[model samples]
Target: MKNKLKEIFYAGLIILVALTLGLAPVTQKEIFSLKWKNLGLQLVEAGVIDQEKFENLYTARGGLSESDKEMLYGRNNRDFKITPENSGMALHMLWAFGLANKNPILEDGPMMDPRYGGAENFASTGGWTLAKGSTMDHYSMHSFVTLTDDEQALVEKVSKGIFRPCCKNSTFFPDCNHGMAMLGLLELMASQGATEDEMNQKAQEVNSLWFPQVEKKSAGCAA
Candidate 1:
């Protein structure tokens, strides 16, 4: 009986995961009311988010440089880490988006690559209209992101790696998926005030891809 029970449990788990990924159309049809909560849960299911993975993404992006400083966007040099406690809910919402068969081309892109527009990018373009009607409130979910100090440092790095110094300053807003998400978070954080520990922590997150450390000549004014 114990063995049978175990098998049943495993089968049930598999079914749940499948349904999570498969029934996206049905699941997403009712996302507006809850918004961020729905997104956070979905991000948890997709490999794209979670505490550890979020931190790793920041680390993977590297740090800022000289040329990065020359640009308006790269000047911020602050941290906007993607921590589980903060951006978890938002990312889960993003996960459900790509699965919804909306913009398969852009929705399902490389998370680490700035050019690889994902749910965040789609939200920047269609979150309010195109994507909103089909799935969760993409804008609200993106706004739900919250980052920790360490994660902010990671954001500084990743922002530089993908967003580039010439892009939008290494701050949270990059005019893409992450960018929109960053903007949403900023709006949410605004009420908390810039002096707040978390908001202040964001100021230090820098991926200065334009500073003296980097060979600016390589992509000088590439944008």
Candidate 2:
């Protein structure tokens, strides 16, 4: 009876560990739908990317509208597709979103704290070079998306839970480049009315894209 009880306990422990570590089957199915057309236009309008740069960037990858030339002009499908080639572009757009979006989290969050030796010193603030002037010129100063009180709260709550592999800090802190980019993505999702669950799902997808080796190692651990 003692041996049997020990086996049962160990089995339960293994199952618990697997679940906690997200060892379940990963899927290729589209997890969430995002309106890229609107987001793209907004990014452009916010000076995240201009028409020439947008065209140049996307065209270099094989034209903005891969199929159905109509997508080139007006709104395309609501489903946001992720691919290896576009992953870097997505990061850039999200970085822009983080920089331009207006929210109290950027103003009052840990990024504003003095311990980081000033916000401009960090990657999120200093790493951005595509903009017209210094990245500080646009750091959390633009009004791309206006979030309501509740929406702002949602961003804050979601940001606290999301962590980046690049650093130990959560998006709320956003000291590094990846954390700041994630913060921007979270803010965009919240302002666009993404549910908490959806935000988490999208975050996982984005992070996986950003760090392929990390995802691979994680999967290997489960195996």
Candidate 3:
């Protein structure tokens, strides 16, 4: 009887181990879906991002794939997925979106606080060099995704809670590129009617992709 019980326990343990191993890849393959259509093309046409400079920046780093190019220059009718491979590109594009999109958060939020000197002084604005003109020229200048008053409030509320590993400031401040990109993503998600829970979940997933090494270490500790 003792021997039989030991065999049953070991067999159960082996099955559990196999199940965990099998599910690990599926969990790691998580993707963030966004209602991205012509937003990328709009960014290019609006001079928020000079196509030549944007292409050159990626060309030196092994060029944009066909799917990436379509997202930038063509009408991507499908919902965009932020995969590990495209997360870096998504970061820059969303940075441009957040920087250029006309929103009260950028105009009246913490970025414009008198203590910061000016909005251009921060990396989120000054650090972007791909614009057709001075980065400030395109700063909060376009209405790519006009949010309702409620949606705007939702964005502000959620942005306050989402912070990147690189900085202590929340996305509401957007002093860095990561913060700005997050702000852009929040606005886009809110505009598309994403609930607060969805916003938080996608934000976490995107952050994991943006800072994979940090996430890996954090995951290791948790495990």
Candidate 4:
């Protein structure tokens, strides 16, 4: 009878552990089966990407970028469709939604998703919240719309001259370029309770400090 009880208790514990693993953040079940391409289609439904823009972005680099796109797009299709499972896909999806209608989707999405390293900051049990908020869409648009063609050519010229030995390419995220740093600073400032007025003042400073050549980078980027 004692041995039988021990066996039953052990079986229960195993079941509990199995359930926990299945529900883990990046488990095989969570990470795989993410409908990334379908999520892209959802962005289309949300009108985040118009047909022209969608085609442009979809065929922009032709399966050659250093980023995960090449690996992600197999002949079958996006085998990994991230749900609320992983932070990376969550961020991208929220970005798509935020980009739509110029809404503060990140706040409603990622900032509320309990992922993408947000627990240490906004929406956590106790972090920070300021009047100045950031949207991932804004960050993306800031880079996209700004930097006119000439400026892009110029920046590309500069980028080529300055070899980022650390950055394996534009996609190697570890490389601390000006753009990434700007986003980080923006997040920090927003969480620090800085007002838009205060942000305007500091925005000028940050643009000069970070993106020296990109004048008025915040023109329509900030909300």
TM-scores, all candidates, are 0.26, 0.69, 0.85, 0.22
Candidate 3 to truth, TM: 0.85
Question: Which wins on TM-score, candidate 3 or candidate 4?
Answer: 3
lDDT string, candidate 3, 7-109, tens digits = 9999999888988888433455646877789999999999999999999999999999987887798786477788988888889989999999999989999
- TM-score of model 2 (CA atoms): 0.69
| Model 4 misplaced regions, further than 4 Å | 1-37, 63-94, 98-223
lDDT of 1 by residue, 1-223 (tens): 9999999999999889988888524522211111223333343343223435443544465532232211112323233333322243343233333333122122223332567444434444443232324333432233234455544444344334333343443323343444434433433344333333444334223112113243333211233
Best TM-score among the predictions, by candidate number: 3
Residue 171 displacement (Å), model 2 = 0.9
Best by lDDT: 3
Higher-TM-score candidate of 1 and 2: 2
Candidates 2 and 3: which is better by TM-score? 3
**Global Cα lDDT for candidate 4:** 0.35
By lDDT rank, best first, the candidates go 3, 2, 1, 4
Model 2 gets an lDDT of 0.69
Q: lDDT, candidate 1, residue 211?
A: 30
lDDT of 4 at 104: 30
- Residue 126 error, candidate 2, Å: 0.6
Ranking by TM-score: 3, 2, 1, 4
In candidate 4 the C-alpha lDDT for residue 54 amounts to 38
